[model samples]
Target: MKKIIVLCVAALSLPIAIAQEKITLTQAECRQMALAHSEDLQKADNAVMQAELDKDIAFAAYLPKLDATATGTYMFPDMDMMGAKLQMRGMYLAGISLTQPIYAGGQIRAGNRLSEIGKDCALENQRKARMQVIADADNAYWTYIAVLWKVRMLESYKAQMDTLFRQTESGVSAGMATENDLLRITAKKSEIHYQLQKAENGANLCRLALCNVLGCDLDTSIEPTDTVIKVSLPAELDTDISMRPELRLLHKQVEAAEQQVKMSRAEVLPTIGLSAGYMYFGNIKMKSEVGGQSFTQKIEDGNALVSVLVNIPLFHWGEGTQKIKKARLDLQNAQLDLQKNTR
Candidate 1:
């Protein structure tokens, strides 16, 4: 009685121990799951975000920057000398500075253009990754379907073979069919049984691979609810390669390289900017130990000033020219890559 009870308990627990979600999926669902779980797709999304930040940074170069600073000092001794008392013990200093770029010899504009192109490239790459993932999932899904259907059809054929073998056995006994016929039937059944086993094994492996692609555990069994049907191909198809993402990315690369060349050329030209600042410092009378002016003041209280700045590049040891040449070469390479990929 105890053995019987234990057997019953084990049988009941078997399913519970290895149970998983019995998900039924169609081709679209499988592709969606793969895209949702793919690490490569997630990284492509991250690249787009980073490219947006790069564009923001490039645009910020033309905006003015305002800065403010303050400082405090403390001393043990406070000195009062002459009519002016040096407030050196408790001193405070503060200033504000502003900088605006009036001209950058086309460098800023070229950088901004390059950043825009880079953003587009990232977006196109993201789209390409999504398409690739979907296509891969679709292939795996359909392959699983074909293998499962093959296994099912072979199983039915085996059953028919079994029926034929039984009828032949009786025929041989009745002197209607030869023993050789029965033997051949038996051999054919064995061959089919072997083939059926191979097909079933292939089906199981296909199921596991599809489950992994769809973000399910390897142990989980997948049930595909979709079936393949015959479809007529279009009479004419467009094989144009202009819509490919790879070619688009290469084109963007060429445009960005052209901008880089412009920036490099700008490096040898003159740059102009505007600067304005306001500074203030507390006046303190020197102690008796130090005898001189009662207070330390330069520029008569250090008035505010605004000035225009210019930086002229006189010469470099062929550095700027070499960089421009290199940028042009990069552009040529990008164009060639686009043509190659199109081919």
Candidate 2:
């Protein structure tokens, strides 16, 4: 009798033993996995980098620019001077110039403002992505916990029915219970066994779905260590959408468009720049030949010059005004969208 009971207990433990092979994860661990694998977060990160680069590029417009040029020439035939060759076979010339914008008609400032707006938009988008991924992870995690608990509940119920079936079978042999009671208990045990099977399948499906969210293999199994239960709310939920990232992104876009309009208007205004340049020309050469004997000339000359430059837009057939108009229209559209999203 003891051996028979041992066999029955072993049979009942087989499914539990199999379940032990699955990995166990907590709710926080699941969220971490989801965030690590989220494609939306990856895209948001790229956008953030692009926005930062744009800001740097715009800032560069306010900085000084320096350029240098060098040229060298070799002559196949030497020039003759007073029947004596100049002996200038090769010559190198180099010039370096620096230009700093004293005024860009407010375009540089407006462009910088636009870059700042772009970065704000990108950050808001990243926040939106993170929020969405975290919410999904939370839902998936709770679902896993709920299904796991349901399976556990069904397994416990099955164990109770197993015990009752044994007691009823013994009573039937002692003539203390009817055959109908034994059959009924046996039927209930079978019913609980089937219910546990269904519950376990459900739990496993939820586990697979959670794995999919974490970007893991669908066939991989997991046992959630969290519990799901309804919680009483302390207060009513707020319906305000002002803090939403989509609305913030739209508002930032409107600000950027307004800056673009400022830049366009500035296009018709004059720009002032300061420039400094250094030029050097000449090469090792000989002085004009005298009595057929020449002296080493060492003729190299360099000069530094600074100048102020002004650029005024003379005529563009209303191009600047057209651009400003377009920018204003875009700003208006963005504002309208923001209002709609807010509602």
Candidate 3:
């Protein structure tokens, strides 16, 4: 029975030991884990991919478009006109048309340019997100390590106080120390104990925060590989801010606004297109009887035609002009924003 009880206690303790297993990780590893776990970075990547697809879609506007059409009709009754009967049974028509844009007033080009700028903006956003995640990971990692050190320091201090309390008790028994001294040491030890408990709780909270950043189990103990930090000063300071992702994104936005202005201007300009189609028709017939002689006439053939189309926006109550002005204003706003951020 004792052996059974011992076996059951060991079985219960096994999972607890496994659950508290320490995981040792370096700062770099923690940052990498955080990067992998960051939803913002993933969203940034998706935005970049969507931008690329938009660029492709914009470029497709420059290519020719093809369309197919088919039609069929049937008549249920014949018609009589002046003693002559006209019979119609079935009619069918099929055609395929190709339309190519000769000119679109620079709208397609400007749209493509805008999509490219959008892609660049998404890339900059991704870079910014990556940097942010890494910074957060580093902060959490170092903060947890610091708190762990604090906990250890408090434990050590508690041990030293305990030793002092014992010595004081012995001295009081030997009459070398007063009871007041022992009481003073006991109160101090109690304070130290309270402080140690608080530090341990703080350390646990910090550990949980680091685990959250790392996307790991909170119950898993973490031991940082770095115990001491090495501080260094840069030999030279670099003040260039143009390469920053935020600044680059702003620049891209400005370029995109310029493209929007161009696109708006294009709305008022003339557009030209070329279209070609081939049509086939069959199963159409007219039956007629004259002088007791019957005859049937059927029309079944195929024909092709090409045409050029031109459009000029004469007027729309100054709508196009207003749009152009609005786009220009937006462009100005973007420029102002860029200037403000740069300053």
- What are the per-model numbers of colliding residue pairs? 5, 0, 0
Candidate 3 or 2, higher TM-score: 3
TM-score of each: 0.83, 0.74, 0.90
Top of the candidates by TM-score:
3
Cα lDDT of candidate 2 equals 0.86
Q: What is candidate 3's CA lDDT for residue 104?
A: 89
Better of 2 and 3 by lDDT: 3
Off-target runs (Cα >4 Å) in candidate 3 are 1-18, 75-90
| Candidate lDDT (C-alpha), each | 0.86, 0.86, 0.91
lDDT of 1 by residue, 1-343 (tens): 9999999999998877677657788887898899998888999999999999999999999999999988888865554556534556557778899999998999999999989998999999999999998988988899999999999999999999999999999999999999999999999999999999999999989988887778788777678888865578888987876778987888898898899899999999899999999988774435333466343542224459899999998878999889999989998998888788766
lDDT of 3: 0.91
Which ranges in model 2 have alpha carbons more than 4 Å from their true place? 1-21, 75-88, 149-202, 230-232, 284-298
Candidate 1: pairs in clash: 85-285, 86-284, 86-285, 87-284, 87-285
lDDT of 3 by residue, 1-343 (tens): 9999999999999999988978899988999899998899999999999999999999999999999999988776877756655555778899999999999899999999999889889999999999999999988989988888888888898899889888989999999999999999889988888988888888899999998988888898998997778888789888898999989988888898899999999999999999999999898777788888988888799999999999999989999999999999999999999999988
Model 3, residue 1: what's the lDDT? 100
